[model samples]
Target: MALPRVSALRASVRAQLSAQCYHRTFHGSSARTGRNRASVLVAGGAALVAGLIAGASRIQRAEMTGARVPTALDGKDLESRCSCFMAPPVTPLEGLRSPDMKSRMELLIMETQAEVCRALAEVDGGASFIVDRWQREEGGGGISCVLQDGKVFEKAGVNVSVVHGFLSEESIRQMKSRGKSLKTKDGKLPFSAMGVSSVIHPKNPHVPTIHFNYRYFEIEEADGNKQWWFGGGTDLTPTYLNQEDIVHFHQTLKEACDQHSPTFYPKFKKWCDDYFFIKHRGESRGVGGIFFDDLDSPSKEELFKFVQSCAKAVVPCYVPIVEKHKNDSFTPEEKLWQQLRRGRYVEFNLVYDRGTKFGLATPGSRIESILMSLPLTARWEYMYTPPANSKEGEILKVLREPKDWVH
Candidate 1:
């Protein structure tokens, strides 16, 4: 039997939202800030806006573009525009020229990002990338292409998610677990499950790395209530200090946020940092970007608009940086060391990452794509040392403290 297409699901959702009278307001505390510790605010009742002011320190920046914005969240055209805005062009799938569905999406997103990365690399002199991959104990899988190699970018790229059987009840359980939640029905715990192939990695050092994801989830009830949702977003990270990059990245994101709510960028940026942190390492993966999940809130139409806004922000925030950095020359040692750092990336995902844990626990999950973030090659050195108080050491210092990326 043929399975349901996501596009079809999206269309159905669009229609349902179009026919409804929907209005929502968002009120929540700001995300945890790294500095002030007390700047959290209670924003107005704009479901479009959630208030949160975080911190700042050292980093780079970038932007992206792709999507149209509605003047008000109350417009009738909101549903159609939001759905059309965020969905990837179908052409990439055709252009990917691959057999596997996941591979097709992976290659397509990679091809698109590589072109953008190459462009930014040409402009930035050069860039760096962080890559890692994982194995899913279940079925199906995916790979990520993150590029930050450029002047305009701090980092950016599309996260391609390809997974079959995503709507299975067991799969939903795995996803909830990753979020530190569990499934319960009739006042008792149920079985867990999930399967997927996904990837995320940026191509530049100056722009700081970033992440984005798209996924499907489901919950099944003994009484037959089946539910599902689509979730994902892009976020930021940096290695070396670059204030312009940080500001540019944040500002571009703010533009998208403002279209929806003045409070969005601030709240989501903070959320991005908190969401992507390596709890064990006591530091964020990079600077920060925007993130959202289980976005099935208020109404699918409203959530769709929010996702569209984030999707549009991607190209504007990241392409320029890639154009700036993809071609600069770097010594083989630097590249090798980059790979060595990649080793740490791998360690975090395999040993401490919630995503990895969930993916491995799900049923019908694919292994290769789940682990595709890993570099083609990587290394580990015994007791590697950074010159005391050097710029390199300075980055290490900040990484240890979870410093704010912007003031």
Candidate 2:
């Protein structure tokens, strides 16, 4: 290679890198200040841009001078930074070489899982998560963290999984039915899915139960092209209706979504209500939060940033409710109602949840992790019903008719 061409190569690298990095910035701002939050975002963006430019310049100079160099953004450096992860990443360093969205998504979920567990433990005070790392015989693995019977929380499970294998014929048919343009040579497609999923059921019926999952999925098409998309959502399931707490949850989620696109919140909120419905009972699983799937629109980078906003919104959305109500006194009847509501949660997950059914049907899937979302306690009396004009009846009415909580 001639020395003159080095300048051209450096320019090309800079252009490519800028294309990928420039679109990224902090996703959301505090809704209170009419978003002077933009100023903070711009400052952060400026810092990131400067750092990226300096690193590229350093690497270019090093190449020309034949000098050794290392960077914090390199995969090796990043692996060290992510040392706090519950388990080693699914993809080896070599396999994760260059244009590294796959590895970045993996790290994001790991970070989310860690953060959620820490926040819950801090609030619980007397309990910490028990981390369980396990591997799938066919492909990848996961870490499941559980904190059970805590002072505040009853049962909490926060899990991160990275798995890759061939999708079965039944799965293929299911995807195709959803309007996915997919084909299988021998009725199988090479696929990978990674995500952070959590279910937090508090001891007091006053503190609502929260559930969320954020995931990225990819499939290797028969033509050697890769097809990828993002999915997952967060929702609230309260034994007793508290309008203020529910409003706070919805508002936080709306703020996050609005930062991405004005349309995202409303569209996904409706999707959440519709998706979580227990068809047999003709009522929603919960008061709805944002739910979206098969999202491969606008651009990959933009969508990734949007997902990050939603993931970060989880803590702000649910933790305040926990702190406020953790010590609130409850009657035995209230506890009984909570258990009965949990029975509905179990029914929805077992019979209606696509994720649960998919995990159950998949070969070599970890059953314990799939079922970890179940609460420690649930009850179903034979055709039991809440009394007329009772508080429980009010909850049933709201569940049957979802509300626009944010507005």
TM-score of 2: 0.81
Q: Name the best candidate (by lDDT).
A: 2
Candidate 1's C-alpha runs over 4 A off are 1-208, 226-230, 331-333, 403-407
Query: The CA-based lDDT of model 2 is what?
Result: 0.74
Error of 2 at 229 (Å): 0.4
In the order shown, the candidates' Cα RMSDs to the true structure are 17.5, 14.8
What TM-score number comes out for model 1?
Answer: 0.56
Candidate 1 residue-wise lDDT, 128-230, digit = tens: 3222222233333332333432343433332334443333454455555557354355534333222222233444333344455544445554565645454
User: lDDT of model 2 at residue 237?
Assistant: 98
User: Measured by C-alpha RMSD in angstroms, how accurate is candidate 2?
Assistant: 14.8
Give the distance in Å from residue 252's predicted Cα in candidate 1 to where it truly belongs: 1.8
| Model 2 lDDT tens row, 1-407 | 11122234334433432232222233332332421111112211111222222222111211111222232256545544344343345565555444456676786787677557656866888574556566787888887778778888889988888899998777787788789998676777999999999999999998889999999999998888899999989999999998988888888788778877899999999999999999999989889999999999998777877887788778767877787888888999999999999999999999999889788878888898899999999999889899868999999999999999867
TM-score, each model?
A: 0.56, 0.81
How many residue pairs clash in all the candidates, one count each? Answer: 78, 0
